[model samples]
Target: MNDHDNNLPAVPEGDEPVPNPGLPPHHWRPTDVDPKAEKRAERQVAAFFGVATVALLGFFVSYFAFQVGDNWDTIAGLGASNLMLGLTLAIAFLCIGIGLIHWARKLMTDQEIVELRHPAASSEEDRSTSVGLVLQGVDDSGIGRRPLVRNSLLGALGLVGLAPIIMLRDLGPLPGDKLLHTIWKPGMRVVRDVVGTPIHVSDLEIGDLVNAEPAAIFELDDEGHHVVEGVELQIAKSKGAVILLRMEPGEITPWKGRENWSVEGIVCFSKICTHVGCPISLNERTKHHLLCPCHQSTFDLADNGKVIFGPAARHLPQLPIEVDDEGYLVAQSDFTEPVGPSFWERDKT
Candidate 1:
């Protein structure tokens, strides 16, 4: 570490700047020597752009083929939609960059030139010279002579620009008050999720947890077909899902003015987590704690759905429930507060 001398020779300082060292010797690429090699390089660059085009097409296919939740396939715990979209978009952009770099290094002008330093501001003559140099550079690029590379680049760029424009359809006319409310309303019966069978308070036993959804989700048309289908059905189910849990009445601590919210010992809370909206029902019966498998957020079902532990910042939303005239458990009204993770207009409600 101490082998080098600490003191070094110092040169005299002057007002005049150091003389220019000049440019290094230019090295010609293989593409510059043989016409066959030049043609091969050109084709290679175009092939990269071609691959980019194919990747963009695959992105579009993945967008349409794979629905977000129920219809999506999975790869290593990641949804195929997410995986394909990210992979394709990354490849598209990467290929474009590689193609441009390869074109510059192998085909574009390689001569070395040195320019003396000049004032920051340019005169009219200097500006004209700069414009001429830019035009000369374009000519030296051979873009006009090589129609294959030029057209391929233009096509790839056009598709790249078109991809985002296609996705702009997701920005709707606006959500209005749609997201502020769910399918749940006063007197709406709480039913099991997939089977859509109405649940009675007597059906639940102590320490039982049942996944449920709003009865409106099963409304039949004149032909006995479900009225809520496709994307609308998915949205309604996501926003209206709840869990019916039965614990000892004495074990529950009702929040202010919420004493009548539960039917006997059966209390209802939104299944969606407050942290990031993952469905949560991993129950600890002894402590009445509901844990989210996604992020380990925990909530206490016996105490107004309070966040008892983990990453959840807010309590799980409680759904007020009462027994119907027919002995079925039904909602008293829509949730007093919006459920699920926080959103931009969540506080507005």
Candidate 2:
């Protein structure tokens, strides 16, 4: 305002605004005119791409160099496997971004081009003009003239693309035999689920139902540590989970050699439903029938946990139990069959 105001001659009171001054003069960069500066910039862009390639290589090396549970491979409490992967992958991505930006800002054309807006349905002459302009812009990008920068960028992109494929190996293997077993064993006390106290046979009266789990999970070693913690404990509780019921021993129709599997009038059966692995606990006390809440499948708990009605194909597995010296109910051993839904390749017979 001040520069224009001082240079202008005084105007009449009711005249129009002063004549407009157009854009300022353009400032040219050394690379825009000097051959030496342009060559230096081309090399600099290539160097950035080269660094990206090295970072990608480091990503692969870090993946194989560190094992997941190794005792010594740690950085700031994170596993070396995780820490190295994050850092190397971050650097790899950052370098590519920086290289593309530098190439666009310095080595590419600095001239400003303008186009006016037109109708959406362009005439043939306008369409031809656009195609020619696109070809001319491609020529200005200097890909043919700059082989080093172009080749380095392509190599960097190709190497970075393989990172995901290499890490796919970490999906690891299946559970194998782990899913077929639980922590229940001979003499493992039947404990109340949340309270973790061993259940005495005398404490449960006739027609009582108790949701129970294995005591091995709550057991402590010499150092006062849990014998089973974390995922192993969770798995044990899920598979070994059962509901204890007290019925008249005279009413139970045990199959073949399972006559002594129960204690007094108390019996235990797996809480997992056989159809789709849902947990079953709802009971019809008078009929001694256990019902699955998910799909209403019912089992006769009084008759060797046999399927009485609904969708379940197999019987609910019964755990053999006996009274210990302290009168607490304990497992004679593990379940004789798998407790959950049928799996593919399972021997149904």
Candidate 3:
């Protein structure tokens, strides 16, 4: 009585505060109590799996239906093949994921259990128990017992793998000798890009850098027939692309064979970078240096486009130029050497 009286003086037993009321009442799911409801859920999950199978089949059909290259058109300019393939595969995976979630929530055992926190280090017994739980989960998944579902899912996944292998065909016909040449031919007129105006030697002044393409690129007959189109046009334009620069004649140190290649201080070189094929136009007029923004590879336009600095391993390819009888700038010939990065097949001659 003495101990109880001393402790109870601060708060009377009749006035003690009430403890918190916890979470809301738990309601049993329809599937938990109704056998018919559970069966309906199982049918819904199976239907989802069936829909996923159809979506995967659609992916395969889309892959073969679309053709590659110029004749290929797109839906609103979005590649039709890519759009269809991506949509179908995404739907297939989504259906499988949704089906699994529905199966777990509606069909699998859903009883709630409380797990107490433990010390950071686990005993050997606890580790073995954890491993056993994982193995039990594997057995419960029914992946081994249901041969039809397992085989069908495996078949769908295997077919998905083929999509990438089929895409390997896009890697190429191998560049071969294609990069070595462009539409640039002997006497082909050099024209201003976009405007398609033929460039005259007199039109350029010292310290000027002009982005130019071959006149043949814009040429069309009276009947609107292009001399080249489709793949051929793309290949030729890629190789033949060039930049024209004009410096004081005294500023240039022409290589022996290229002495007459320039007209009135105007020289031309391949716009493609020797480092990695990035088109370059950043020109330092005062130093006669052209810089590639991609890797900062610099070339001395005054000294045969020799790599003066940065990571460029080779010189930019020079396009020999001469003024034709009509006074329009024309290619003296194709680049004596290949343009862009150095390759194994490059013969230094």
Query: Against the true structure, what is every candidate's RMSD?
Result: 11.0, 9.1, 8.4
TM-score of candidate 3 on Cα atoms, chains taken together: 0.57
Tens digits of per-residue lDDT, candidate 2, 1-349, equal 7546789766777664554455467778888989999999899989989998998898899898887764758888888888888898888789889988988888777775544456899999999999998888777888768999999999899988899889888798666876567678899999998898999988998899999999875665687866688887887887889999999889899998999999998999999999998988898998899999999899999988888799988888899999999999999998888878988756674
Candidate 1 Cα deviation (angstroms), residue 146? 34
User: Which sections of candidate 3 miss by over 4 Å?
Assistant: 1-51, 63-95, 98-114, 119-128, 159-182, 192-211, 217-224, 227-241, 245-266, 272-287, 292-296, 333-349
Alpha-carbon deviation at 84 in model 1, angstroms = 29
For residue 29, what is the lDDT in candidate 3? 90
On lDDT, the stronger of 2 and 3 is: 2
User: Per-residue CA lDDT of candidate 3, range 222-320, in tens?
Assistant: 988566867876666666778999999888899898899888899899999988889999999898899999999999999999998998888998999
* Lowest-sum lDDT 10-residue window in model 1: 1-10
Q: Candidate 2 versus the native: TM-score?
A: 0.56
TM-score of each: 0.52, 0.56, 0.57
* 34: Cα error in model 3, Å: 17
Clashes found in each candidate (C-alpha, N, C closer than 3 A):
0, 0, 0
Off by over 4 Å in 1: 1-170, 217-226
Instruction: Give Cα-based local distance difference scores for all models.
Output: 0.88, 0.87, 0.81
The C-alpha local distance difference test score for the whole of candidate 2 amounts to 0.87
